[model samples]
Target chain A: EDKVVQSPLSLVVHEGDTVTLNCSYEVTNFRSLLWYKQEKKAPTFLFMLTSSGIEKKSGRLSSILDKKELFSILNITATQTGDSAVYLCAVEGTIGNQFYFGTGTSLTVIP
Target chain B: EAGVAQSPRYKIIEKRQSVAFWCNPISGHATLYWYQQILGQGPKLLIQFQNNGVVDDSQLPKDRFSAERLKGVDSTLKIQPAKLEDSAVYLCASSLVGEGITFGQGTRLTVV
Candidate 1:
């Protein structure tokens, strides 16, 4: 079964702190890894990583994938309360547009 | 540049009751997806449609769950005799070829 596992299921940190979330996957015919931030209802797109070593960044958020190791990491620098949300990791497979998603990491940035 | 649209932001029904949800994908988007998101969990793909054809519905519980995308623009998902365990957020999303998906505010379902 294709599976995506995310570590640190939940985290709490003070404002201005930095945090890192982890995601590991096991699947056949891996295509790409994606990150999303879900606040209340919908999950907004974050980053999509297809190549190893090349990191994708946006403002204070960044992510990287390691295909060989079958893992990925998302980093948030200078986190604020607004950054508190569930971070999800998903992997798209080569088999007919299928995607496996991890349970997600719930982040709470306390002010 | 409107995003994916979904209706019935919230629904409450007794177990064994039936309910339906609607979704309107972004204009020209070829792929539409319906996902179920339980509390504290990431979204799970329930079905996928390519244009007006069913591309994937392997995970969908066809016994009581059915969905259709007519005219390749809008879609609807129906759940018959909903169970308490079925309570969750149903998310609708759409994506163009080789593009990231755009999600709509999900419909929160509560089966009492």
Candidate 2:
């Protein structure tokens, strides 16, 4: 069975703290891994990592993929109250190019 | 460019009722996807369409759910006799093949 799992189902951090969210997957023909930040409305695209060891970054958010380990990590630095949202990890597989998503990690940044 | 568009941003219906949601993907995107997201979970793909044709619908509950993309641009997802478990956010997304998907402001469905 193809599946994606995320650790620390929920987290709480003070403003200015740094946090890491983890995602692991078991699927055939792994194509790419993506991270999304979902607020109350719609989930916004964060990053897409297709190669191992290469990090994708934007501002305070960064992510890396490990195809060999079949896992990925997303790091958020200097967290702010605005960063309080659910972070979702998803893996896309070559077979049928289906996307399997993890039950997101909910992070709450308190001020 | 305008992002993906979905209609009836919020809907409340009684169980066993029928309802429909619409989507208009970003212009020129060839692939469209419909997803169901229950509270505290990630979105689950319900169907995928490519240019008015169905690429996948294996997860869609055909017994009471049906979807169609007309003219390869606009799409609609309908649920008949919706169950309580069907209360969820219906997200519509679109992308070029092999690209990161763009999502719309999903419709929140509440079935009582």
Candidate 3:
């Protein structure tokens, strides 16, 4: 079955800490991997990575995909209280343009 | 460009009651999707529509759930005899071919 799994279901870190979240998947006809930040009810898109080894970055957040390894990592540097939210990992396939999402990593950044 | 729009930001109902949620996809987006997200979990795709046709509804619980996009523009999802497990955040998203999807604010449903 096609599935995505994320590690460290929950995490707590102090401000300025650097944290790495992991996502691994097993799916057919992989098209891309995406990361989302969910605060309260809405999930906002963070990054989309389709190429392996190439890192996609914005401000203090960055992510990279490895098609061969079937896994990806999202790094958040100099974290702040505002960074506290559930980080979701999703993998899209070419079959139906549908996304399979992991349970997400709940992150709490302390002041 | 305007983002996807959803209605009734919040809804609370007793179990066995029925409810309907609405969605308006981004203008010009050919693909639309409905997802159910439980607290602390990621969103799960319930259905996907291309234009006004159903591309996928395998995960949708059709027994009591139904959806339609008649004009290929806006869509609605209805749930009859709601269950406690059905309490979730209903998210609507839309995207053009080869582009990432854009999500709406989502509707939070609570069942007693």
Candidate 4:
């Protein structure tokens, strides 16, 4: 079985629409869930979710983690063309700093 | 602070040739990482270094691949007799205290 799974391998939306990306994981010694946005080259860190329930937000992007189900949700409101990129979900283990990453969701926001 | 730096932004070499990628992590960062990402795939960790010592290199193909972090500042990943399967983007990332990671632009390798 895979350690991390991301739904909707690709997505398309209007500039003003809202989009949600999902990630689920099953790893031993789960520690934290992280989200990153990749455009042309390297993936840049977006949010880090260590605790559940509380949402982490930056601009139009927000993410929340659910330890019970071992899942995470990334929500983008009022999306723009600049927001078009691949969103990656990563799960870090507690015992070791090993991180398992999802395949990523390709998001395209049309202007 | 300057972000992680990688050399030879892109390389296209024939199979069986040797190629090397270099990385310079952010200053004061204690941990460094090397990752391989095939086309349309997520980055996969190949090695990890803590300061001047190696923390993990289980995913590295020791038979044909080698890496070294000299002075705990700069790192070099070399592949000898590279195979077609070795074509991928090699990324170097660094972190302090594991809060988050800063990644390099990556060195894209194309084994023709």
- Candidate of highest TM-score: 3
lDDT per residue for candidate 4 within A1-111, as digits (tens), equals 438899889999999999999999998887788899999879999999989899999999999999998899999999999999999898877654567788899999998
| Model 2 stretches astray by more than 4 angstroms | none
DockQ-superior candidate, 1 or 4: 1
For candidate 1, give the DockQ.
0.72
Model 3 misplaced regions, further than 4 Å: none
Tens digits of per-residue lDDT, candidate 3, B13-43, equal 9999999999999999989999999987888
Q: Model 4 segments beyond 4 Å from truth?
A: none
The complex in candidate 4 yields a DockQ of: 0.65
Clashing residue pairs, backbone N/CA/C < 3 A, model 4: none
- Please list the residue runs of candidate 1 whose C-alpha ends up more than 4 Å from where it truly belongs after superposition: none
**Candidates, DockQ:** 0.72, 0.71, 0.75, 0.65
The model with the greater DockQ, 3 or 4, is 3
lDDT at A105 for candidate 3?
98
CAPRI quality band, candidate 1: medium
TM-scores of the models, in the order given: 0.95, 0.96, 0.97, 0.93
Q: Please rank every candidate by TM-score, starting with the best.
A: 3, 2, 1, 4
Better of 1 and 3 by TM-score: 3
Q: Compared with the true structure, what per-residue lDDT tens digits does model 2 show for residues A14-84?
A: 99999999999998888888899999868899999899999998999999999899999999999999999
Clashes of each: 0, 0, 0, 0
